[model samples]
Target: MLTLQIYLNRITTQHNGATLDYRGQFSNSRLIVADFTQFVNDIQAALKSAAEKNIYTPPSKLFGNLRATPICLDVREQLADGLSPVEYKVLLETLMAVCNSRAVKPEQVLYHGKIPFQAA
Candidate 1:
């Protein structure tokens, strides 16, 4: 099984758009994304694409900070094996809800769930 946990720490709204500071645990690997200005829109687009294509790859921008690292590959591999397109859509929807909600506290866990590995 693979597990995911995401937390939002702060949001800065600028004249152009909002930027988010967040962190996440993809199974056992931890990562932080700072000043992610297009998080909401990007995730929504990803959700749409995944629905149409029946596959999901975490947005490249979402892990920009970890580019070229083994962790990025690990996350992609785990997600591919552990979740189906339908399951990934659900996860993206949960992420969208968390990003849209004002009631969330800083650093509060936005999502935490297990996804059983999909059989080949």
Candidate 2:
């Protein structure tokens, strides 16, 4: 199983909108996403797609460093094929759970999961 961790560093709300500062860690690599609300939306959409289609396509924005890394669900499976439909659902649920928590101010561990991994 692969372990993934996401931390929400801070949230800034303005009259126009709210921006979230967060980071994700998988293995030795760490990714920082700053002031991106679309990231959350993309995750939610991917979760819906995974549920409806049993397939996950990672968000384009995360395609670079984040997606390039090998975060496998199983030792024998490639990253692309590691996650089962149920696993995908659970992974997204874990993330959404953290997102829904609405923990503001101070850094918070948004998500932590050990799963057969893959994310759309």
Provide the TM-score for each candidate, comma-separated: 0.24, 0.25
Q: Rate the local accuracy (lDDT) of all candidates.
A: 0.31, 0.31
lDDT per residue for candidate 1 within 55-96, as digits (tens), equals 333325566323311110011232323444443444444454
lDDT of 1: 0.31
Looking at candidate 1, what is the lDDT of residue 66?
A: 33
Q: Write the per-residue lDDT of candidate 2 for residues 30-72, one digit (tens) a residue.
A: 2223323543543444344332443333324545324422212
